[model samples]
Every structure is written in structure tokens, then in C-alpha cells.
Target chain A: MARTQGSHSEITGPRVREAAMRLFARHGFAAVSMRQIATEVGVQAGALYNYTPDKQSLLFDLMREHMDALLDAWQQEDPGGTDARARLEAFTRFHIRFNTRRADAVFVSYMELRNLTGENFAAVTELRRIYETRLEEILRAGQDAGVFTLAEPRITAMAVIALLTGVNTWYRDAGRLKLDEVETLYWDMVRRLVGG
Target chain B: MARTQGSHSEITGPRVREAAMRLFARHGFAAVSMRQIATEVGVQAGALYNYTPDKQSLLFDLMREHMDALLDAWQQEDPGGTDARARLEAFTRFHIRFNTRRADAVFVSYMELRNLTGENFAAVTELRRIYETRLEEILRAGQDAGVFTLAEPRITAMAVIALLTGVNTWYRDAGRLKLDEVETLYWDMVRRLVGG
Candidate 1:
């Protein structure tokens, strides 16, 4: 029984998350049910409890994982150097690329924040603030070096992130501009915004 | 009977819309039901049908009205001179102010786009494009007059709008910054972005 349950868990865990993410992105957290998720995952509704305690937990887990992956990916992609300009450019391109590829997760993360319980909301909010701080630190470093001009580093960081993430709204791979072209266009704008 | 029905609608129509907007903004369109909206409006579920055919119509009407009001407000607020720089500044401040004032409508318009049916989505998308074109025209005029440096005016317009609309996510009337100060900060960023 232990061996059978272990195998089932391994196979269904990722499937459950993928299904939840897809459904939540499509219909939103408040609208989607455990039954609907189970239907999507090809599992009995009772089987889903073995994986997640409730829909809120599932939503929180998805949001937390999205943030964790984003931070992790940025860490790996960080062109570790003292040059703030280069780091900002790297960040611009990286954010647009990462978010466009995971549009569903990005949409879910942004749209479902109100549905989270207070404690869960706080946890996800902190994770998001940590991610935002990554860019804020870069901006501050640049300010310290006199490499960037800004009235407020923190606000600039938020604006820059918003600009980059906005790409996911209308960007299509089949659209007129290629991904690199989009990145370069945004990079140029960011460079100007920061006076880099 | 006709006079009584007219009087009831005159009072209940706006209430129904207000409740729907508040609920949809809080819980998302897909999660909200006409019954729930009616309950919030102090009406029967069946009475909601007297106001809107269905939830999709309500969502679409809310979005359309938001966009229409946005466009109309900008039209009224436009500086309307040949100076692209002045016009762009007006747009930056105007967008931030207007959107922040109607945070719930803005949230619903963006977050519930996926919930809109195809025809409704297209209608809203067209309206949004028209609004974006307002900014794009400013960018293009700036570029034409050598007042703004832009690789793509359309993309720059979208970026600026996103950056301005982002203020709604964090701005509060009781926050440290006054509305005018926030507007000036964003206007400065917009100037830098456009090379004005």
C-alpha cells in the first residue's frame, strides 16, 4: 500500500499543480472548485486532498512557486558584475522573456491576490516584495555609483517592472516583432528611464 | 405599471452596476453570480435580469463604460496643442489620475478580460486600442517634431500607459506622496522616456 501510494503521489502531484494553475488562470481561484480541478487532473475529488489541503492552499502554493521560480531564475541569469547598466539591461530582457513564457502563471499571480487568505496573502506579498527588492537594490547601486538618475529608486524599480511585464499582455511570438527586437526596444526605453 | 418599472430601474440600475463592479473586482467576474450581485444590491436574483441579460453583459458594460469614460475624460483634459511634449505630459498625468480614481473599474477591466465573450472582448479591445492610439499619436507627433526619440511609437505608448496605470496598484490618497507630486514624478519619467 505504501509503495502504491508513493507511486501515485509522484505521478499526480505535478499534474495537480499544472491543472490548478491552468484552471485558476482561466476561471480564477474563487470560481474554480476542487471538483473542477480533480476533473481537470483526471483524479477523484477525494484523491486531491492527498496533495493539497484546500483550494486556498493550492492558490497560495502556485503563487509562491511562481515567485520562487522567478527569483531563482533571475539569480541564475544575473550577469554578476558591478555595472548597473548591464545588470539593468539583463533584468529588462530576462523579465520580458521569463514572464512571456509563463503568461498563465503571471496572469494568475496578478489577478488572484485578493482571493488569498490574510496570512497566505501576507506570505505571497512578502515573496513578491523580495522579488521587487531585487530590482530596487540594483537601482540603488546604480544611484550610489551615479550611474542612474532618479527621484526615487524604489518607485523607478516598480515602474520598470511594470513596463517589462506589460509585454506579456500583447506580445505574440507570431506577431510582427521578434522577441529580441522587443527586448532591445524595451532596453532602450529602460536605459533612458534610468539615465543609464 | 410602466411608470413604476421605470422608477425602479432608475434607482436600481446604478445600484446593480455598482454592486457588480465591487463584487467582480473583489472576487472576479467568473466567480460572481447575478444572484450575488442582486443580494448586494438589495434586489432579487430575477430582478438583476431586468438590468442585465447576464453576467457577461454586466462585465462588458462595466468595461465599456470604464473605457468610454476614460476616453471622454482624456478628451476633455487634453492640452490640445501642437506641442507633443505638453500633450504627452498631460496624457501621463491624466491616465494616472483617472485610473487611480476608478481603481475597481480598472481592475475589473483588466482582470476580467478573459471572462468576456469573444464579441464583448473585441469591442473592449477596440476601445482600448483607440485609447492607446491617443498616446501613440502623441509619441508619433513628438518623434516627428524631433522632440521624442522612439524606435516604435506604438510600443512606447503601451509602455507609458502601463507605467502610468501601475500607480493605481500602489498609490493611496493617504500615502506619503500627494497626487500632484506623484503626477510630477511620473511626468518626469515620461519626459525622459520620450526624450522630451
Candidate 2:
């Protein structure tokens, strides 16, 4: 019963997450069943208990994992660099890449957070706010440095996030638009958003 | 069964739609049972068929009605006759007003269309495309007339829609941010986006 997908002896966690992500995306979070996810993972419904406490945990697990990966990817791609324009572009590329590549995860990350319980929801909420705040701070720094021209950094940040997230709603893995092309369009828009 | 929440005559059409709106927004379109909607409307499950032939029809009926009202509001407000910036501002205000007033209907209108089937889906799809295209044409006209400055009119229109739609994910009937305040913030961002 102890299973982790890539770990030494555990395959349960990742498998359950994979099943949950697919179901949650295709059907909204509240509609999906634990039994359905268990079936998809090739485990009995009871076997899923070893991996998650309940459906809400399964939902949070997918969301938190995606956010962690997102933050990690950003940091790994640009470790300890704080140039505003560069950071903005990096953020643009990272968002487009991660969001487009993981459409289900990104969709659930945005739409299903409300389903999480008090503490679980709090953690995800705080992390998301921190990510957004850092982006705004970078924009403000750019404004001060005279590299980015923007009005209302916080509003612009929210607009950028909304615009970038829209990419996932229509972007198909094999869609006509390349991820880089989409990324470029957003960068252009955000640059303009910030008066770049 | 009949409903008269506002200026409606009977509970059948409006009542069915009202119930569907709440259920769809709460549980989503695909997950809500026709029987449940019937119960919410105070009618026998079979009697609900008098108004809508099926669940998809019930869903599409509410969507088309919402969009129709939205289009009517835009026209009644004389959104078209104004200058580019005014027209854009009209759009910002109209969007917030419609979505806020009919929160449940607007939620389903934006998020639950894919659940519609056959002619029901096509009708909603075409109307939606037509509405969005109207915005795109405005941006294009503004850009061509030199009143607006946007690198890409089509993308700008879509981004504006995204910003407006993002309102539903967080809006409350009574929140720290009032609808007018949110509309103002969006208007500013939209003007910046369209180079107003």
C-alpha cells in the first residue's frame, strides 16, 4: 500500500495525483469521485487511503505540488537574480511554459482552491499571495529604476496574471500557437502593461 | 410552477432558469441533475420538461438569456455611439454590472458552456463569438482611427475579457471591493491595455 511514483518504495502518491488531476480537469472538483480516481490509478478504492486522507487532500496535493513546482522552476531558472525587466521576462516565460505544459494542474490550481479545508487552503493561499506580491515588488522596483513604465503595479500584476492564465483556457498542446510565441505575445503585453 | 422574482409572468421558464443558475454555479453544469433543478423549482421532475427539453437546453436557455440581456444592456446604454475610450469604458462597466447582478447566471454563462450539446452548444458558442468579436472590432476601429494604441487589437480584446471575467472568481455581493470600485480598477487597466 505504501507507494511513491518515483521514490524508493512508494507509487501511491503520484498515481493518485495523476488520476485526480485528470478527473478534476475534465469534471469540476466537486463532481469527481474517489472511486473513479482509484480505478484510474489501478488501485482499489480503499488502497487510495494510504496516499491521501480524503478527496480534499487529493485536490490540495495536486494544487500545492503544482505551485511548488512553479516556484522551484522560477528559482532554478534564475537563481538570486533581481533585475526587474529580466525578472519580468523570466516570470512571463516561466508562466507560459508551466501553465501550457501542465494545463490540468494550472486549471485546477486556479479553480479548485476553494475546495480545500481551513489550514490546507490557508497554506496555498499564502503561497499564491507571496508569489503575486513578489511580482508586484519587482514591477515597482522596475518603475523606480526607470526601466518599466507602468501605472499601479498591483493592478498591472493582476492583469498580467489574468492574461497569462487565459493562455491555458485556449492553448492546446498541439495548438497552432507555439508556447514561445504565446509567451512573446504576453511579454509584449505585460511590458506595455508596465510601460516598458 | 411559476416564479416572479422580477418582471416575469410565470414560475416555469424563469423559475427553472433561476434554479439551474444556482445549481450550476454551486455544483457546475455537468454535475447538476435535472431532477434536482426540478425540485428547486417546485415542480415535479417530469413537469420540468415543459420549459426545457433536456438538461443542456435548461443550461443553454439560461446562458442565451443572460447574453441577450447583456447585449441589450450594451445597446440601451448607447455603448456604440461613443468614442473609442468611452466605448471601452462602457464595456468595462457593462461587464461588471451584468456579471454582478446575475452572479450565478454569469458564472454558468462563462464557465459551463462546454457542457452544452448539439444545437444548444452551437447557439451559445456563436452568440459568444459574436459578442467577443464585437469588442475586437471596437479595438480594431479605435486603432485604425488612431484613437487607440495597441500592438494587436484582437489579443487586446481577449485580454480585456479575461480581466473582466476574472472578477467572478472572487466577487462577493458585499465585499471590501464594491462592484463600482472593481469596475474602476478594470477600466484603468483596460484603458492602459488599449492605449486609451
Candidate 3:
């Protein structure tokens, strides 16, 4: 019976997470309740507890999963053997491509951070720092190779991340530019920003 | 008498707005109640209604005031007669300086925007656009004068605003870099971004 329940959760868990992220993005974490999430997922409030302990855990799980996926995806896409310029371009395009597709997750990740518990928040921050450090490493390599000129690699990494991530706030699929064109435009901007 | 009550409100209205902004910044708009704001202001819930009709209005009022103050300050600081590069640097530094000073207002302005009614949201967006247009105009002016090379002024303006506004997300007074240093670094990035 426990094995069977685990199998069931493998299916329902993602559904619950999807519902929770949507509601949290729309109504905010503090305003959203477990019952509402249950209603959205077509489960009783009691049954929802089987998947997650409470709303805080639900939120933390969502954010943790987001960070985990982000870091994992970047790890796969990272061009470990490439030169600094090539690696920086890959990271730039990958961030915009990945984040634009998951707008809600990105929004919730940035907005609801204050609602997380101290330990949960620290974990999320660590994951975020790991991601930042990836880009920082690219900058450091470029600086060492004299391909990129920046006063500080860490600060440039943060600024570059902010610039790329800001794309989600205004991008539209139906807009004039295609995603490829946007990637190019942003790449040009970032390339110039670091004196590439 | 109506005149006496109006006179009383004149003094308390700012206090009420200050309390609402603080509470809304601490807890989200949906999570905070009028009673809490009233208590923060040392007034009864019923008395709070005298200044603003409801919670939504209070939120709208706070956002409106923030935007208004932002635009007004930028207007006074805007070097209308200067060239595009000079104007851009002024806007960049002024934005960082002004927004960093009013962190609460900036936080609520970005976070609680979803809680606003359609009309209120539209109003705030309009104010925000007006501000964006100020930067876009400078970009356009630069492009037209053969000084700044950019494909799209509007998108570049949005990107620049995101880059500048992002300082508030990570900047700390006790950190190594002073605010002026930050402004200079960002100005360098922006100047290069536009090929200035």
C-alpha cells in the first residue's frame, strides 16, 4: 500500500506543485491557503497534507525545485571546455531561454523570497549564489584572458544576470521580435557591456 | 464641521499613507488589513476610512504617491538642455539615488502592483510608462544624433531601467562600494551598452 501510494504521488505531486505555483504567483504566498490549492488540484485539504506538510513547505519545495532545475539545467548546458566569450554567450542565451519559458516560476522565485523561513531562504540563496558563481566564473576566465574588461567580475555577473532576467518582465511571444532575435539583441548588449 | 475634519485629515493623511506603505511593504497588500494599518497609525479602523475610502484606495494612493514623487524628482533633476549621454548619466544616477533612499516605496511599487484594481493598475502603469518614456526619449535622441547606436529605443530603455533598478535588490550601505561608485559603474555599463 505504501508503494502504491508513492506511485500515486509521483503523478499528483507535480499537479499539486503546478496548482500551488500558479496560485502563489497570482495571489501571493501569504494570501494563498492550502485549501485553495487543494481545490485547484481537485483534492481534499487533508489529502494535500500527504504531499506536503504545510503551505510553507509547499512554497519552499516549489522554490527549491525551481533552483534545483535551474542549476541542473545550466550544468548540462554549460560549455565547460569553451573559451570565456563562447561560454558567456551560451550562459546568456540559456538564461533568457529557460526563464522566458517559465515566467511564473521566475516571478514567484523573486517575489515570495521574503516569505520563506530562514533556513529555507538560506538554502535557496545558496542555490542562487551557485548559479551566479557560474556566470562569475565565465567573467573571471574572460578577465584573465583579456577578452572581457570589467572592474569586478562578481558585480558584472550580477548586473548581467539582472539584465538577462529582466527580459521576462516584458517579453511576449506575439511581439514583433522572435526569441532568436531577442537572444541576439541581448547578447550584443551583454557583449558590449563587458567589452567583449 | 466639514472644514474642521478636513483640517484634521490634512495632518493625519500623510501619517496614514506612511503607515500603509510600511505595513504593505512588510506584509503583502492582501495579507494586511485596514485595522492593522489603523493601529500602526494609532487610529481606529473606522477613523482610517476618513483619509482613504478603503484598503484598495490606500494601496492606490501609496503607489500613486510613489510614482508621482519619482516623476517629480526626476523632472527637477532632468537636465533638459543637456546632450543625450549627459542626460542618460543624470537619469541613471538620479534613479539609483532616489529609489535607494525610498526602498519601501520602491518595494511596494513593484510587488503590490498585482493587488491593484484594473483601473488602479492602469494608473500606476501609466505613471511608470511616463517615466520609461523619459528614458526612451533620451535613447532616441542619442540614436538620432548619431551618438548612441541602438536598434530599438523602447526595449533598450526598459533594459536600462531594469539594470538601474536592480541595484536596490542587492546593494547594501555597509558593502564595499559606495553609492557613487555604483552609479559610476552602472553608468559605464550603460554607456557601453548604447555604444556611447
- The DockQ leader among the candidates is 1
Candidate 2 regions exceeding 4 Å error are A1-11, A78-82, A149-151, A173-176, B1-10, B171-178
Deviation from native of the Cα of residue B74 in model 3, angstroms: 0.8
> Least lDDT summed over 10 consecutive residues: which range in candidate 1 chain B?
B1-10
In model 3, how large is the Cα lDDT of residue B38?
A: 75
- List the candidate 3 regions with Cα displacement exceeding 4 Å: A1-11, B1-11
Residue A152 of model 1, lDDT score? 87
Q: State the lDDT of candidate 1 residue by residue for B83-115, as single tens digits.
A: 999999889889998989999999989988988
lDDT per model vs. reference: 0.89, 0.76, 0.89
Model 1 over residues A1-196: C-alpha lDDT tens digits? 2234445565367799999999998988988999999888766777788889999999999999999999999999989789998999999999999999999999999989998999989999999898889999899999899999998888888899998999988999999999999999999999999887
Tens digits of per-residue lDDT for model 2, B31-105? 789889878877667677766779877777788888888777777874576487788888888887777677677
Error of 1 at B10 (Å): 6.0
TM-score-better candidate, 1 vs 2: 1
Residue lDDT tens for model 3, B16-105: 988889888877889899988877876667777777789999899899989999999999999987499999999999999999888889
Please give the distance, in angstroms, between residue A110's alpha carbon in candidate 2 and its true position after superposition.
2.9
What is the C-alpha DockQ of each candidate? 0.81, 0.45, 0.72
